[model samples]
Target: MRTREEQQSDPYPTTVEIHCLNQFLMEDWDEEWDRISEELEEQDIPVPEGYYEIQKQILDLHQDMSVVEILESEEDDDGEMWYTIIDVEEQKIHPGMPRYALMFADKPYSTDIFLDNVFRHDMRVPDSLFPQTWKNRQAAKYQNM
Candidate 1:
C-alpha cells in the first residue's frame, strides 16, 4: 500500500460529496418527470407512450427499458442519500436486485459499508454490526461526478 503521502497526493472524492451530487440529480429527475406527465396529460395521450418517447427524446434515455429513482423518497425535496438504477429486462436474473447505488457520508473503513448499513439501522458501533455473507457486487457510481 502507498504511504499516507501517496494517498494524499492522489485524493479521491469522498462518499458524502458524491451523495450531494445525487441529491441534485434526484431533484432534476423528479421535476423532469412531473413536467412530462403534465404535458402528456394535457394532450390527452397515454402515459406509457408519451413517457417512453419523452424519456428518450427529451430525457435522452435512447430506449424504453431503464428506470431511475432515489432509494427511499416520494418527492424531490425528501433529501434521500441513496439512488438506484434499474434495468427492467435484467430483473429476471436477480428477480429484484437494486442494480447500483451512490451515497454520501464519511468515507468508510471497509468496502462493504453500504451492505452493512442495509442490515443494521444502527451505525454507532461497527463491531456490533453482524456479518452479511450474502454476495454483494456494488460500488460508487461516481462519488463526485
Candidate 2:
C-alpha cells in the first residue's frame, strides 16, 4: 500500500486510483455522497478531479444502481485494512464502513493534492485489498462473460 506521504510527492496532488468492484444504486448514491462531502468539508479535504472520474466510471458501468466498496489499509495491522461500502441507490454508506476517499484514478488532478486530502482525513488504503491493475483485470474478465 502506498503511504499518503509518498503519493503526495507526485506532481498531481489530489488524485487517487480506485478499483471499482461492483455497481451501486443511484438512489442512495446522493445521500452517501452528501455524507462523504460533509465529512471532507469538516476536515477541510479537497478531492481531485480524477477521483470523481473513477466514481463516474463505476456509476456508468453499473447502471442498475448497486453498491461499491472502498478498502483502506489498517494502521495497526499491515495485513488488514478497512472497507467502506456505499449503496448508490440508497445514497448512504453501509454500516461498519469507513468514509469515502476522494479523487478516483481516472480523475484529473495531482498526487500531492490527493495525498493532502487523504491525510487531512487521516485515511489509508489496505494492503490486503486488490490493486487497481487486478481490479481492471477482473472487470475485463467479467465484460466478456
> What is the lDDT, from 0 to 100, of the residue 76 in candidate 1?
32
Q: Looking at model 1, which ten-residue stretch has the lowest summed lDDT? A: 92-101
Tell me model 2's lDDT, rounded to 2 decimals: 0.48
Each model's number of backbone clashes? 3, 38
Model 1 residue 74 CA deviation (Å) reads 9.2
- Residue 96 shift from truth in candidate 2, angstroms: 28
TM-score of each: 0.22, 0.25
Model 1 C-alpha lDDT per residue in residues 22-111, reported as the tens digit of each score: 222333555665697899789998766455545434433222223222223222344422334322333321111211223223444535
Candidate 1 stretches with Cα past 4 Å from truth are 1-27, 49-145
